[model samples]
Target chain A: MAETAHAASREHFGSTSRRDSWWLAPGLVAAGLLLLGGYATWAALQGTHFEFGRYLSPLYSPKIAAPWWPLSPALLILIPPLLFRSTCYYYRKAYYRAFFLDPVACAVGELNRGKYTGETGFPFVLQNLHRFAFYLAFLWLFFLWHDVWDAFWFDGRFGVGLGTLVILASTGTLTLYTFSCHSFRHLVGGKLDCFSCTAAARGRHGAWLGVSALNEHHMGFAWISLVSVCFADFYVRLLSMGVFHDVRLL
Target chain B: MPEAVLHVYRGDASGGGLKEYRVPLEEGMVVLDAIHHIQGHQAPDLAVRWNCKAAKCGSCSAEVNGKPKLLCKTRMDALPPGQPVVVQPLKAFPIVKDLVTDVQWNYEVNKRIPPFTPKPNAEWRWKQEDVDRVQEFRKCIECFLCQDVCHVLRSHGRTDAFAGPRFLVRVAGLEMHPMDALNRTKFLKEDAGIGLCNITKCCTEVCPEDITITDNAIIPLKERVVDDHYDPVRMLVRLVTGKKKGE
Candidate 1:
């Protein structure tokens, strides 16, 4: 057996560090997620500035209760998006490496805790909620569209404004994000065995391909939609606080 | 004659670095062919493991230009001309010599998994659709590239905990088999450490067989783990009946 000689020949390269700037990507992801989480938390807690003349913050859209509902309006509507992002296949990797340091990057050494309990345990296991949360997120899109419809009406008259455009852009990007989800792709037709056996199955296959195309850009959509949601909320909040003027485009 | 600079990694476990060799390039030469030329003429002692010289055997797996690929499949033309094609052993495994790494750990992990267990005296009948997903996983050639790219094993050194993407695909095939009656959810949750994978899809990206490791296999297996361990309704049912769903 060459095992003995091979065992003797084993060599270790000291800490496989890349020459290029590998830390920059994960560092950016960490900063971005942190900024988004902090901003969303602060905005959600305030409960005010989520609405203006016609615009509603993406964070508190489909305002389910009265202003005196006691609970933060953001909390009421945060469940769907929170579950979507938390259980997101892509975001899971991002945070797992960025925050958990589960081998920070490819080939880079990670925290040697000797034992690892994956998502099967407590809070991490909650990530399984993503599939269920996907249903909620799919349903929440309608409310965002409804808000977009309301955005066009200023003072009850049909007119376009800066808030309308912002809300529209936000909804558009979120639509891309929703459709591009890995879960959504699997749900569409990833489980099918025969794509050409039936007429409806063929159509489903086509839809799956379409979703697969978008899934290729799932990461890009994730970041863009995240930024767009924050911008949408900030736009509505600033307008509500009289910090920014709503330019009439009609 | 057109030539390419091959910066092949040369050294044993104690220490090593890249040793450059200029090989005369042919019209259809691959990186493996260049290595063979170097082994034949220049460095007779240069060590590289290969068999079949085709993409199927999975023996010539290495990192070409810092990407995990089968050496026989990566053509010289595919890489940019006038640049040194850096070839190295897989970073995830321990280097034995030159481009050969000790991939025995993967075989060890494979042994821990329970083999396919079919029901006794059960009629063996399944529609093509039923086994189609499992068939996708059956295409694995044990290349270990998935294990190489996996951060849980390659980066985090969680070989003890995580089974990497390759075994997860194997478990997926067993668990999803319509005729197989064994429930590996417990093993998946605890022993294999399925939760450690955050579904980066890097394994899928690097897979030459086009197996959808993350979406089709790993994610669905993760769901089974969650249903068995975490679901409140399932937990309550298990408490009341003293029996699991698979039972």
Candidate 2:
């Protein structure tokens, strides 16, 4: 109250709630996503669609395989948003409004203010596991790009060639933009001052600055990432199902 | 064509109930207009704080029914009229009268954060990209809606621990810039309690300027905290190399 306009204590101003209900409209949407994911998984197993069988094959290697992989655990984007809510005034209010109140209207999980419920984990806690998830997603993306590469060109069989480089570049740029995020960067020790002074650190910072510049408009990336991930999954699914083609241009 | 019910929280900290006031409806009118009409006609002593009614200054933030919004920009017509429109003070800060809460918590938090520290070793020229990193935070209007609604500040009152989202963004602007030499990671982890934030993302939802407060600021700060405190390997590597990050 010393710095505030009102005489009210911090206690006087409190959030209604911010936990979103993963039911009703949001739940239905999530269910649809689950169904699509399930179908994609199934299609990959069957090898009827894109390579119905090969996509499910453990023998196949993705574009960015484990050996020289650039993808790390820091790529998770959810952590920042989650961490932000814990410290934000608006998020506290919205958190309660969305999840605690009508729960059904909310698309995500709930919170107990500062409590990190370990046993019956809430959606808010999913942010912590983001680093690992991002690693898997990034790995998959690299593989998909590799698959696109294998599918391109004239000496062409079922695989590709030169034009396939474009897919690799597109995915690479998207991953760079996503991974270079303030959130992901933070996850990877980006806020570390030493990195700025080190050899590749400065240049990486330069690359980060380039990406972060694009990232500063993160709400843009948030939307585009959402769209890209969905589109990428759709492409994979279509190819898996044989319902669509990769259209090799060599 | 219809009348709207204004559900006002009546009473001081002593205790208050919601008082209902009926207002005539019109097109293109904002919630602020109705509050003003009610104040002028029925309750002259009704306490509310606002300025720059154009929504440029973030003074008039309040819960419209339940959402955090600048009353000036919230069109009454956009809200669902079937239920009572509940207008309440911002939740994170203390209430002065009605819709106004003490926003000074923000200014104080801002003070605790490290100021922009430019490295003294070299020329001051900066990349336009570096400048862009922190500039997004400048769009903040100090509505404190983000501060008022934050659970750490509101529910826990950990003012001594956390700096809240508003200050986090303020700090991010200064800390992330390539031109800034002052390492704020220590302050972020220790003084500011960056690890305390759980990334619930409630701030991103209510930001009027649409700044991704959680994704852009808190996450990065948390990452910094992890590098400083949780990640042992990175620390050893940095120590061996004689380079300290967020120092």
Candidate 3:
């Protein structure tokens, strides 16, 4: 590791005077994100078991089919959500600290990359497109909600099942995640300087307040939504493979 | 009365080590109270700075039990019952004597930021919502606890570039103000080094005032910075429409 000198005699990477379990947070965050990401990637690659009788994997929602596009349908649908998540404000913090080891944990030593530009240039600068991705993610939410609605159709009859509940949980958590986005919060309410000046502004202020409330727990929603989406796909995959029987709930 | 062991750091910038002092704990007492007991009885010159013994003054910022906290606010009972509570100077700044470090660096950084400049022909008729938004940032008592907890300053020693979380909160207050006009995005990008922050939320965790430093303050400011400097689409729109940024 490259060395950066300090007035107090700086130490090497990962060095810290902290006595607490400082490494636990970043370690778990890295492992969790990697594990979830790995599962999603693997599931996306396997196009065969993405659908059951009524339920469709969230990874392959809106089931795209074209003669030219022979690849997994999941590949087409996952990009927007992946971009939205990869650029998310909360996820950026998690992955940056966990994967980049940028100061590892607070007050803990980090690798000396000499000049750290953060999100101002190159690939990192692409994070600025988060707002654009937010639009796409917001649009995709409609598709996800549609899939949740379709999950109830069994033998051309509307009925609830375990798969319906799983898909519902996925869509619900994802809705929370998308609505609680910082960009969405800014677009809805944060931009307005005077809320009471105009009727529209007042309406936006109410939206901002609601978004702010949800934004407070954006990190929690992010994790839960990630897990739920993966679980939704995993359950549907199992059902499609006839490994796990889907129980009719209604 | 239970006696608590206080492991307080002694000496100055040259070097120092933890000195064990046993203080008699009192009912509803704080870590600052224990330090005061040490001053009153054992060591008369145990240098520790404090004011408004309430958590409001932002004084007496130190690392208690390996966490950056206000000594005046840390309850004695809140710490682990048996273990010695270690009190160290804010490791980010240059040590002055004991627990007092040269926090003047923060004040210097405070000077570099442009003050709130009201917009030209501005009507100061903002609603309570605007007030509530900026009011969260105004709650900062200049504690420097957020500064101490920030790893860019604390560990990486990027005081030369990064302006830490405290000043970022300051910038957020000014930038978010409806009537305010001055654009500091260039300054935020260059001198203040807003990009260096990875948004760990450590500053938010350690803040006694509970200001949402990362999510509310820093991230919004980062978005503004992105608008002016990084985003191509926004830049193209500005270029074509001849619209000023943040309009």
Candidate 4:
């Protein structure tokens, strides 16, 4: 074989022979993650202004009514959903490249060289908790949907408001994100060695195909849900702060 | 007659650079056709590896204008007009000559992966969905465009540690096989270095077969690895039930 380690081919950080604008993707991802992440952190810090007459911020959904807890209510309920997003297979790829600059784009040089440990070591090994987080996120969806249900009940009567739509969008996207999770897909169809071996396996095979189709768009759902969750919170916050009246669409 | 300028790389591991040639353009001429024109009319010694011009054989893999692509699939007219079309060897491998790199490393990686081993007295039956699931991975042509685009091999030069997306797809086919009994998760975790793939998905982007390499193969394989190596809950369940890992 011709020599494997050709010295000229090894590129330094952010360097490559690639001619296209390679930085555009990782740059945009970083900016978006930071912006949204910042907003989530800020919103979580404020315990007040998270609820509007009938609607509740998704960030504070299934609202923890424990007055004994000293911090923002959002902080207590946000951990599992936060862990879900953090350890997500798609987000790991996105943030690893975008935030860590671990080859910010494919074939692009990165800050770390041969010293890479990937997810095999400390801290990153925690990423394996993704499935556990997936379960939590899946269960968390019920509370969000309940909040959406609440958003429709105004003045003890059923009525649709813009806040209802906003909360619904948040819950809907979160549901898509949860159902389309890589771990969920694997649990549904991927674990089986023989789909034809059993009737249940055959059923799982069908479910797997559906989840596989959804998994293809998991990254899109991840981004859209991120934005939708924040937007829902912001909308509710505005209403609760009396900055705007809830526009009834009933 | 309209002609296109081609800057084909010409040299070996010691070093080399792109050599320009002009070829007459045809209605549907591909990059491989232009290279053939250069070989026949201009430079007979201009070495290039190609088996089938149909793009299915995958022997015509190279970087065209800094993009990993099959030369047979990339049409001449599809590229930017009036600019030199550059063809070079795959960056991840060692150069043997002009536009031909040592892809032997890929074959070596393939040999390391255990092939499908069926269970004892296992039923041969499997559903269409199982076929459909593994079939996507079976479509890989071994072009190594995925390997060429993979940063672990191309940039990090961690061929010692990482098995690129191509083999991951290969393993996915075997691992997901209905009757296969082999537990290759140990090989995946320790040797294949499945952890190294961050899954930015350029392999999926450059694939001519349109294989969902990242989403279908790598991620699922990684999830399996998690089941074996990382999931303490699964481990505890196995312990409580007195069941083996794969069972």
Cα lDDT computed for each candidate against the true fold? 0.81, 0.58, 0.87, 0.86
Clashes in each model (backbone N, CA, C under 3 Å)? 6, 54, 0, 0
Q: Which stretches of candidate 3 lie over 4 Å from their true place?
A: A1-8, A66-71
Which prediction has more favorable DockQ, 2 or 3? Answer: 3
In terms of lDDT, the poorest run of 10 residues in model 4 chain B is B122-131
Residue range B136-165, candidate 4, lDDT tens digits: 888889999999988777777778788888
* Model 3 RMSD, rounded to 1 decimal: 2.7
Candidate ranking under TM-score, highest first, comes to 4, 3, 1, 2
* TM-score for each model: 0.79, 0.67, 0.94, 0.95
Q: In model 1, where do residues sit more than 4 Å from their true spots? A: A1-24, A31-48, A62-80, A99-101, A111-125, A129-146, A152-165, A168-221, A241-250, B13-17, B77-83, B118-128, B237-243
lDDT of 3 by residue, A1-250 (tens): 1112334446578776567899999999999998999999999988788889878888888788766888777788899999999999988889888998875787677787766677656888778789989999999989899998898898899999999999999999999999999998888978666777789989999999999999999999999999999999899888888896999999
Q: Say which candidate scores most in DockQ.
A: 4
Ranking by DockQ: 4, 3, 2, 1
Residue-wise C-alpha lDDT for candidate 2, range B46-140, written one tens digit per residue? 77778999988988898776567899989988887676788887766666666766666677777777777777887766555445557788899
lDDT tens string, model 2, A136-160? 5455555556555454533535554
Fnat for every candidate: 0.27, 0.15, 0.43, 0.45
Among all candidates shown, the one with the greatest TM-score: 4
Candidate 4 docking classification: medium
